[model samples]
Target: MGKSRVHWLRFLRLTSSFRRCPLSKRSLIIASVCVFHLLLVVSHFGYSQHQLERGIDEDKYRNARGFYNLDISDALSDSDLQTGASFVVPTRSNVVYITLKSKRLKPAHIRGTIRPKLRRKVRRKETNSAFTQYKLVTLERDAGQNKRNFASKTSLGETRDVYYKSLDITYISPTDTRIDSHISSIRIYSQRAPPWLSPKDVEVMRFLADANVLRIKEVSHGDSPTLLVFEGKTSVPKKNRKHTVCGGQCGVINIPVDTSEVFAFHLDRVLGLNRTLPAVSRKFSFLHDGQPCPVVSWDASLYPEGLAAGLSTVRLTWGEYQNSLKQRCWHKNISPKPDSGCFTVHHYEWSKLALFDFLLQIHNRLDHSCCGFRPRQEDVCVELGHHAQCGDPNHIQLTNIIHRDHNPRHLVFTNNKGFFDRNEDNLDFRLLEGIKELPEQAVSVLKSKRLREKLLQSLFLDQTYWESQGGRQGIDKLIDVIERRAMVLLTYINAHGIKVITMHV
Candidate 1:
């Protein structure tokens, strides 16, 4: 009340003073202007005081609520990359930010651009004959619980022919400390079969080495002279195809081993076995942090059983085979005999394989050792021979060689390395000692001029491949050895009076 009274008295005094002095028009106008300016200042002070009471301070919430100029590069680190995490990716030019809403119930919103490093060119269909190229280029939840691995899905429209080694990806989420967090674990996963592969059993393998797929699934390491097998896959043509289909040999790869494996397949095909795994020579390369690394690979197939297992399945060492043969006696009254029941059972099939090994100069197999065999059929073996051994239990007749092939006589030939290393003069014939008959069809094919031509052509298919592995000259020697060996086998059969097993193919 006192303050109000004092303000009223002061106003009245001011009015009285003005009334006494303002006899002219100019003085009265000046007094009115001063009073209006004083009222305006008072109203501004009241507005400021009201704001202070409501606690509206922008500086206090500046850190928690504001736009950020962060790019994807700023958020990601070396650990975020799957393959070439050590590589330095270029920074993205796009902008991203986070927004902190004022309402207590409303959560913070985040937004960002996803820019991955360009690994390969995605070809864009062009109207002109010239091709146009487009570059097509994931996340973390926990230290251990949240693995940042990623796989390609057709739903994402990532089905491109070119493969990507690494991707630069950025994302934003409420769980992130900053609105924009770099996802270091971005990876591309896909599976595709190579175009050149023809076997229906292994056609799916082409995508295993597709340039666009990720290759970190299951890398195998073996004890041989440093073999690194990389497991890979490419996207299937069908959009809805599952990415996790069993890859078998179609999705597996290795360095030096594949070279040998593919060569062996060629050998098998030329020899008319048609039992070896399918494989094709392929040149593989990739970029690591922008550096190029090229490799030669043989994309081989994984079948009902691989060549390694097939070569040794039901096989026994030569000594073991000899001992087992000695244990089998056909008659109760007769002494145990080595050739009684065992010799006639696998003679034909073993003879064929012996010839095959001799031609390739593959010396790893021996009589005491049975190198390969098919799955056992007890009824089939016992019916064929009462005392047949598991490795070579049945005679493969020329008329029906393929009918009961699943039995022990199948003898899948595999791992055919060691071409020109062993001395050809002292070629091992222990595997041929039991030969009593030969397949006439196989023998005729072997003696045919076409066989020689096929062998020559097959050996020449990978001239560059053998040369790279220090075996081009060895391949030439191999051809010479094959021709000479074929003639020797025919001569031996004629001299020994071995009967021909005639099968009409």
Candidate 2:
């Protein structure tokens, strides 16, 4: 009976096991699937975020260049310029003054006619022929503030394809990118890019330019009570009377440089970077009262994206435009080697700027006993005057006047007899040979104006009063008054052994 009972129980158990439902197994499977999907979603979001940052990093890395990028420059329309406005922006680009100290080099001069490249003969235009206009941008910083003061904002930009012939020179480029050899720290402050352009686009464009100054030195020594200068090139040990820009890779921006003063960029200001890209470099420096007043210091915030952050990549690509001037005039393969030099408002630069071609014209003049007019080159080259110890100590001499540009650069020399004075835009009306004559009253006015200008520069520098008064009309009138009587006054200054154009700003 016991054995029979055990068999019956076993048969019942087997039936129960078979009856267990598949629904329970399905529920377990569903739970597992939900967990796997949740984990995948989280992983995907994390990965997507990482990828985005990587892309941005790649962008910044590739676009890192040695110079500052980002600006608030406006492209002035013809109407705007015609209206006597420099640009469309209501305010000027935010400019900062950077005071840098190095050897103040002399400027070069051309001993020839100012206009070297004669205008091309006019030709009929084809509809398809494209014309281009090239222009350079410029900025001026205060003369006194080096690392001593910083400008809050800077404004700078470009005007390209401003002139046209057969080609559509009227068309501004879709992309406006600019690079220059030298720049005032104030101008870079204005280079911040607009939101429309990508964060790295402006920076990338800057990196692509060949315009650069070698990190020449990164340290310097200055007079007592003077703050030290930050340098960009040399890594050597400290030395007395040495100057440097701190060998930085040029990726930092808006760094609160400890001090401030006024600074000018020789490498850029005179070159077409502020006017037209003449291909290479023209740089100079100014010394006031045998000493420099301010030293230009760099700020990181004013530069484009990565540059102000102290990134390392600082290489520029030399585009075809860089050598355009050279290719036109020079055959570098010439026998004694082609002489290429820089022309500027410095005494030392003249050595490089003067050419045998110009000297030969000066030396090889023919008799002008009877002629319609002697060639200006042979007949007109005269000594305007000499600059001896005007601004320099220990006797640095610079002879200023109009002469010739022997090289392809066509530099100008001899203007109103002062070194560092350029007569490019009729700005230096100091040349009074044009005025027929000067009345005694005009001479008196000239004397008073010069005396007042020299004595009251502080009044002229009063921005609040001047800006409130309005455009340079007052100064203009004074300039006109001086110009009319300049012949006699200039003669007087020359006779007094005073280099009028070489006065300290």
Candidate 3:
């Protein structure tokens, strides 16, 4: 109270002094003092407001950071639970504390939560939308209709299994019942094994299909397909093994776009020709961006003269080839004279090759000059000017006429690049120009109307090829082409009066 009284007396004295001065000067001083006091009061209020705002902003920032820390803590807790480890998070002021806890994860829970999601994603990637939609519709239909008819029809479990099998999304182990019991090494991916495949063929196919590829290199010569060396045990006996690379197991990898080799292999088998190497469609992740490629069993015997010499090809001009076919060299175990201009290949081999090439339109061996058919500009014969050389029928040389070194009498069909795109009007008659006979077995197959069924059954063995060619519908179209060609061939045989002889050799 005394302090307040003293301040009031001092203020009164100051006012009295101001009153003693001139009236105008005193009023000016009083107005200046009032303005200065008002400015001071305004500055004090603004400072207080700024401090309050700063406190609120700091609180808000702290809350945001607290939420961020909580999220990190949750992630850490998940990691800890997965790894069965503990973590310590430092405490901070104005931040909520998150407790770290560890829990054991059950195998069933993990699989149930993660496997289905992963499987679904993979299924989507592997299949198109149309296929998935079809499967879904099938499942819905089966469930709706089969529920009441289960007693008379197939069981519900079997119906569900069929749909699941069609998806082909389930994982199959290497050792499964799909593999043939006698030939354990070979895996049969389809529903049934192809009866045409022998045990030795199955073994070689298994090596080509599933063996680990060690290295890939060109066949040591220009204008040759790539060869893939596989690291595994081959089915060949050690005494008969002649190949030095890849421990005698190797495969010729055809390009992704060149699927004719696979078709030719199946055709050869179905016709009972048994000349083409075992070829199966497989995918190499390292090559062609994982597209399906035709892998053919490689026979080192084809390169007995070494890889630099290329295939054991029979060097014969067109006239010479036709002349040798007419001479019927080495028929019935009779050898040819030195001046006969006949090669080591037997007579029946040409007949078989002619019939085979005519059906498949493989001109690389018999008609390298595109003389038999109207070739497009993109064809190798036209692009490389081979078609122009057809003028000199006596000089034009045959190419890709390969045979094994040890067995020159029997031809081994390599580079079986058949064409299904050729129309009936443009059939290659030149291939069968000099042929006088066709294999009885092969002609019988053509005569029978069961060609489609046999081809389907044989081709279904290679699941990769079956699916790669757009499944059953696409495969049926290819068969339809062959069937048309077969009809044409049969008509030609009847018109030419070619003998359908049994070629046991």
CA shift of 310, model 3, Å: 2.1
Models ranked on lDDT: 3, 1, 2
Instruction: Give candidate 2 misplaced runs (Cα > 4 Å).
Output: 1-89, 92-474, 477-505
- Give the whole-model CA lDDT for all candidates, comma-separated: 0.40, 0.27, 0.69
Over the full model, what C-alpha lDDT does candidate 2 score relative to the true structure? Answer: 0.27
Using lDDT as the yardstick, the better of models 1 and 2 is 1
Candidate with top TM-score is 3
lDDT of 2 by residue, 1-505 (tens): 9999999999999767646748787678679999999999999999999999999997775555312222333233466447643321211233322122222345477587576777665554455332211101011221123212222222111112111122332322211112232322111222232222222323322322221333222111121011212222334554621222333322111112110100011111211111111111111111111111222323222222222222121121122112222332222323222443312222212222221111111111111111111223222222211122123212322222222222212323211111112122222221221122222322343454442332122122222222322324543433343244344444644555532221110
Give per-candidate clash totals: 26, 98, 0
RMSD of each: 29.9, 30.1, 28.6
Task: Quote model 1's TM-score.
Answer: 0.40
Candidate 3 TM-score over all chains jointly: 0.62
**Winning model by lDDT:** 3
**What TM-score does each of the candidates earn?**
0.40, 0.19, 0.62
Point out the worst 10-residue segment of candidate 3 by lDDT.
155-164
Q: Is candidate 1 or candidate 3 better by TM-score?
A: 3
Name the lDDT value of residue 327 in candidate 1.
47
